[model samples]
Target: MQEILNLEPQNIWKNFYDLNQVPRPSKKEEKVIKFMMDFGKKLNLETIKDSVGNVIIKKPASAGMEDRKTIVLQSHLDMVCQKNNDVQFDFDTQGIEMYVDTDGFVKAKGTTLGADNGIGVATIMTVLESQDMVHPPIEALFTIDEETGMTGAIGLDETILQGEILLNLDTEEDDELTMGCAGGLDVTATKSYSVENLSGDFKSLKVDIKGLKGGHSGGDIHLGLGNSNKILGRFLHESLNFNAQISSMNSGSLRNAIPREGHFVISTPTANFDELKSALENLKKDILIEFQNVEPNIQISVSDVELATNVASQDETKNLAFALMTAYNGVYRMSPEIAGLTETSNNVANVVVGDGEMKILCLTRSALDSNKKNLSETLKATFELCGFEVSFSGGYPGWRPNTNSEILRLMEKLYKEMFGEEPKISATHGGLECGIIGGHYPNLDMVSFGPNIFGAHSPDERVEIKSVQKFWKFFVDVLKNTPKK
Candidate 1:
């Protein structure tokens, strides 16, 4: 990690190193909040914290640039905490051990390097402390809990901010300016089942599916990646030919993460046990062929396990399996206005059976209100027909793009002048805090851009080394070129 401290952009890297010393996982950002507060107070800036733990620090403009309008630099404080299964580090007590790789990427050792928003936060902090920066008044807004629920963005008081121009530094691409993002909501369906004693004449087995590349449910939904729940559902649906009964089912842990692994316990009559094994082998082959390109590491294994006393009835098991097999699990539509953009999609995120109840959670997203509603309602109706109680929660709005805004025009001009190339203007399918924040501050002109980052929200997350230096230069140039109030 010493190599990171010696990177070209000392200001940003210094602050980012400090951030790595604090644990700030989603919903648990107290330590990082205190760090920000102390850092602001040390700089003699007017720092305040909102009821929901959002921090706003005000810095006066440099001597000759007071006439420029105040710009709000925003980034969330929390990161998605994901570590390799074999790693024993605890997120609550330990900080992420980030390292500079030989490939010129900043990554953590067996964990997610909080560079998603950490870099953004560090850049804002560096700008706040710089005395030579020729900028207007600045409001550094640090939000909380963005990874899981977006509690900070949703609950923030818009009145606390005095800026009408907001710059969100949370996007992943370095050469792209994100103008808009999709709105999203979580949908969950539940059903009850009765278990009966398993006959001694039946054999039990546990089927495990592993090694799939489960990515972001929203950003990677259109990538044709395999969903573990859906894959297991298909296997179960076909395996029913051998009269296997499901004892219990579980898949995926987070709703926002596409499932990478799944497990199902099953019971088959002793008479057909051999046939059931043969059938599962054939089904595995078919699944492997189907996802051969995208999910090359896909693995399916069946192991003998001790029999359980109770298992779901054949009818109940079959119904659940078929329901999962038919559920919507990928991009449903593409944007007509923007070429190659996803307009609507669904992620069949998680499924679990426990305590006589089975729950299935799916997430839906769209840029248009009507499309979001229509897709969500369609999912609800479809699952209801499967005899499961369905409900929606945590709906957030989408950020509407302002193509003719003065800030965007200025940023574009400066970017081209500095880099000798035009930045790509685009919209993302994933949920961004800009949407929720924009909903509250209707007059604010917002745009998001950042350095290059890859494999976010997973253990493979990494930040590009050269992109950080380029992003820092662009950021400083923007500050020196802010338009007059």
Candidate 2:
């Protein structure tokens, strides 16, 4: 813990350590809210906690920078809580336990490091309390529940902030400035199915799917990684030849993360058990070859399991399996304007089957609102055709790009002057708070940039140490050069 506090730019790292000591999962940010409030009050800054749980701390400009326009430093408070299945820790009860690795990365022990927005929050805190830094008047806006939904930004009071420009510190890449981001919609499909008695003649097998690199549904959706929900569907679809019936299924968990593993219990007649084994082997080989380049560690296996007294009825079983196989998954469209940019995508995030009921959850993202609706409708139609009731919620607009804006030009010039390499001008596929906040403050100039953080929204999340130092240097300079009012 002392070593982490001793890292370069001690102010930022120490604040980060202090922030992570509170249990701050998405939609459960009471402790962190109190922490931020106390930090602001203790520093003698004017802090306001809005009704929606967002925290705002204001600091006046320094001597030479008082003529510059005010700007908002924004980051989310909640993090996506994910851990290895073997790790036994409670997110609602414990703070993240992180360590600096020998390979120049800071990571958590078998859990997500919460660097998605924790570093940004810490950097804002440092600037707010700094007496030596030259910067414009700052309004530090710490939003809530960004990972689960943009409810904080969505429900914010429009009159609270007086800033003319907004700086979002949530993007992952260090050398990239994010000018726009896609909107998101949560698509859920659910239904109840009938159950039937399992006969004594049925032999059961547990099909396990594991080892896929599941990541952020929007940021990593273009990577073409394997989805466990879809993979389980494939295995079940293949089992039709053996007359297998589903007894229970549990795959994936979060609506924002790509599912990495699945556990399903299925039963077939004893007469067909021998033939099922051979067929399973063939299917596994084909799946491996299909994803060999990206998912070399993909594992699929079947083992004996005790039979349950009941299973999904034959008709319901076939309907669910076929729907899972036919449903939309992965990137739907690529941006014709930008090379290698995903325009629209979907993640079959989770699927749970048990207790004679099933629910399917998916996340859809796109920079265009019409395209967003189109993809979502297409998914709704697919599930509806399979006898499931579908609905869409938590819709947020995308941030439109302003390429010729003052902030973009200023940051681009500063980045090249400092790094000797032109920073990449790009937009993120991930859902950023910029879009929602921009909707309320229509005239505010906005751009998002941050240090290098990778594998966000997953347990493999890590942050680059060297990149943080470089980002800090550039950040302070940007504040120092804010446009004059």
Candidate 3:
């Protein structure tokens, strides 16, 4: 903790330490709401907590900068709650245990370091309390539920914000100034089937797939990382040839994260159990050889387990396995307009089957509205043909890139002057609140930039220390350079 406090940018890290102490998981942010409210009041700023739990703190311009345009600095309050499965910490009650990694990154112990947006929030807090920092009139917006549904940004009352420019500090790469981001749709598939009684001669076997490098489904989807759900589903689908009957299965958790672990229990007649086990073992070897470079630590283990009383219906099991194996994942398409940008993609993030019921969740993303619907239709057809009811909800439009943006021009010029090189102007595949917030305030010129944050939406999340120092200086300068009204 002291090491973090000693960083070059003391204010950002110190405020980050204090902010991390309060639990701020998505969908459950009551405590954080209060924490932010208290923070604003303690600074004696004009703080207002909206009816929908968004916090806005207004600060007057410093020195002679009152003629500059009003700027709204924004960051989400809630973070993606993910952890190593073996870790015993409860996100709901315990503060994240953070440490400085041997490698130049600050990370949390077996949990996500909330640096994805926490650093932005802390930056805003520091600016709000600063006595001498040059800036225009500032409205600091700390939104909630960004990691999950982005409901706070969606539902924010439009009447509050009076800013002409919004600087969103939520992008991952420090050098990349994001003018756009892909929208997202949540796809849920569900069905229930009858379970048949296990025969007396049946034997139980447990299978596990672990150690794959799961990551942010949006940012890392193009990396070709393994999805545990896809891995287990492929195995079970292949095992069906040997007449294996699934008793229970579970894989992944959050819809927006790539799955790292998968587990299932199945049974087969004792007469041919050996043959099925041998085939599975051989397939594991093939899998290891197939993904040797990417998934060196990936393990596919099988062991004996206590016999289960019921097995999922054979027909239903076949359908479920088929759907999982056929479900499209990974980079669906790259942008034609922007070279090297992913235009559309899907993550088969979660699957569960047991107790005569099965559920699957997928998050699909695309910058083009038509492509988004088309991809969702393709997935819907795939699952529906397999006898599952698919539904879409929690949809949010992507932020369209505005090449002629005034704020973008100002930042581009400022960045070149400050760093001696032009910043990368790109649109992210990940979801950001700028689109939603912009919808409410059409005239607001928005852009997002942040320090380097890697492995977001997963337990491996970390942020670079040096980049925070660099980003802080640039952030302050942007405020100092706000255009005259």
The sequence of per-residue lDDT tens digits that candidate 2 reaches over residues 212-257 is: 8888998999999999999889888888888888888899878889
RMSD in order of candidates: 1.6, 1.1, 0.9
Give the better candidate number (1 or 3) by TM-score. 3
Ten contiguous residues minimizing lDDT sum, candidate 3: 308-317
Q: Higher TM-score: candidate 2 or 3? A: 3
Highest TM-score against the true fold, candidate: 3
Q: What clash pairs does model 1 have?
A: none
Give residue 159's error in model 2 in angstroms: 0.7
Question: By the lDDT metric, which is better: model 1 or model 2?
Answer: 2
Instruction: Highest lDDT: give the candidate number.
Output: 3
lDDT per residue as tens, model 3, 362-453 = 99999999988989999999999999999999999999999999999999999999999999999999999999999999999999999999
lDDT of 1 by residue, 45-87 (tens): 9999999999999999999988998899999999887776568
* Local distance difference test scores for all models: 0.88, 0.91, 0.91
Give me the runs in candidate 3 sitting further than 4 Å from their true place: none
Each prediction's number of clashing residue pairs:
0, 0, 0
